[model samples]
Target chain A: MKRVLKLAALGACCLALCACANRPPAHALDRTCEMGGRHGATGVLEYQCVDGDGVIRERPQPIHRVISGGRNG
Target chain B: MIHRCPWPGEDPLYIAYHDTEWGVPERDSEALFAKLILDGFQAGLSWITILRKRENFLEAFDGFKPETLARYSEADIERLLGNAGIIRSRAKIEAAIGNAKAWLAMREGGQDFSDFLWDFVDGEPVQNRFASMKDVPAETQASQAMSKALKKEGFKFCGPVIVYAFMQATGMVNDHLVTCFRHDEVKALSRSS
Candidate 1:
């Protein structure tokens, strides 16, 4: 019984360590921009994410379209 | 290209944010305010902690409206202290309310924080072709200028490093990896802008 209890405790500790090891690193959450193409041209596109209630989330799904100096209509 | 969501092996909430919105540039003033407050709360805490409590932040902070949040009273602060949805740090919680008031004051002075901020990048986005994550930097001169200006304006929790993160998130700078699919896409967008 004593040996079985020790094995159980060891297993629990390993599981806890495994859980901690799987956490994401801080830098991974940093914000960034997604550029679609080249510079100084009308085709250049950029997109950022914001919460759903905000204007940044107004774009269509799958692909959020942004054209510089152009109306959304 | 593994294309794993930026915050790998985290809960689905974080994974979804990573894959969909982590680095996307945001320009709207209200959205910017929301992100700014959230990032401030994220200081010295794992992002997963912030992500877990995002809904609570939104609810407790009146959806992050500068005008609404600026009016939060001591009672509100006390209420938030006990809320499980946000980081309960007294300093950070206080900073969010203070920053909101500062933002409101900026608007009162005929300055839109969005316009003020986007102007730093010359009304356009900076496109960087980083080959890997390591190639990106945590702070830049532009961020330093922004941090300085924000501090002058009475905003808190906006240090140079955090300002750079803010800049990247709002499309003032694009740090996507050159080989990553999003890099060229954002670059193309900037040229057209």
Candidate 2:
């Protein structure tokens, strides 16, 4: 019974983490930024995304350096 | 991939609006009028606040019919104050009525409001293909011109920033990113229309 209860708790922890991870990330909110219409300039205008609620999470950036195939050193 | 505007989960209403109409161009006179007033109310508040209260606005403003709204009396204002469907500010509420009167006056002068509005861009929707969010702007020359014209015509609550947002919402411009799926679709519709 003790072992079974421990496994159940571990499963619940993983489920909670997965649920939290599945929520929309901050960069996903940037997808709504568009540049056409009356404003003739380019750039992301400040828009209230998600009704001003919810936390914005930053994604981890890649650390590896990539070399361009067409560029010469 | 399904292109969605950032800020989904703010609320179901906001999510629906972002997915369906945030950057979509609008053209109908009534729809334009509704958006104009709504954007003005959004001056210092989150759009989600406006969206959540849209039903109240619609009910209070007589379904956003400019002609009908133009006839609103002081009693109407009193009635709206007690209703919780829209922003309860006296100034903003009164501005909607004042703007409706101005809109009707413009119509009486043989000017189609849509045409008058579209004239800023010479009847063609401006198309933008920005790759990153940093490439968009808050105001533009076109919005400035439209703002000037509307103010000259006695309309209030229409600043350049508001006009620019109006233009985007009403299809006067296409500000979708190249990678966004709706960008090409909206562009094609603009070309065909």
Candidate 3:
């Protein structure tokens, strides 16, 4: 019984290491999108996930607009 | 309801500008020069303020002809300062005159003003499909380079931030929100250009 318990603990540790090794960094996940070209009547930008989080979501996402700094008067 | 950029709101003149002029590529060297001067004047005021007085500005500035403006005398400056129809900031007026001289110099040097400005964007408009105002950057690397180049060429009030806005309005870059009706239309115009 003691040997079995030790093996089980070792397996759990290995599993955790494997999981982490397979995961991409948080920032990498955020930056994984690819430009998918313009879409719809309004021609908004469409980004497709080429890997990780975006692939899992399975839907193209629209990113934020870059606001120019100035009064724009 | 037809969707448009939120910035234009419901003002008729603003809407008209947004629909017909804003983001449309202007390749004419003289027209581009005039717009740049107008944008410089827009530094501390709302665009509508200048837009409302555009006719007066055109009349007062002699159609923004660089040949004419480069020769503006002190009397002309004084006359412009006293004009109630246009923004009467002496500094801005002076900059316009100086810019005209700079423009003339560029032409004399055999550089096309429109080509000089468009070269920053590789002779085409940058089509950006930003989803909202928040995503639109106030300045970009291109604008920074353009600003530096302009200042080196003696143009004033052409800072990166101001240059970026000018880029958007002049269609060197298309900043209309993807949800705005003008976005695709402007993009199409860019292709045609």
Model 3 misplaced regions, further than 4 Å: A1-73
Instruction: Compare the candidates by DockQ and give the number of the best one.
Output: 2
What TM-scores do the predictions have? 0.69, 0.70, 0.72
Q: List fnat, each candidate.
A: 0.00, 0.06, 0.00
Model 2, stretches more than 4 Å misplaced?
A1-73, B7-10
- By lDDT rank, best first, the candidates go 3, 2, 1
Output the better candidate (1/2) by lDDT.
2
User: Cα RMSD to native, each candidate?
Assistant: 14.1, 13.5, 14.8
**Tens digits of lDDT, candidate 2, B86-180:** 66666677888888988888889988888889889888889988776566657789999999998888887788887887787677877666777
Highest lDDT against the true fold, candidate: 3
Docking class of 1: incorrect
Q: How far is candidate 1 from the true structure (C-alpha RMSD, Å)?
A: 14.1
Ranking of all candidate structures by their TM-score, best first: 3, 2, 1
Model 2: per-residue Cα lDDT over A1-73, one tens digit each? 9999999999999999998874565555533311222221121222322312354332211100111100110
**Candidate 3 — what's its lDDT?**
0.78
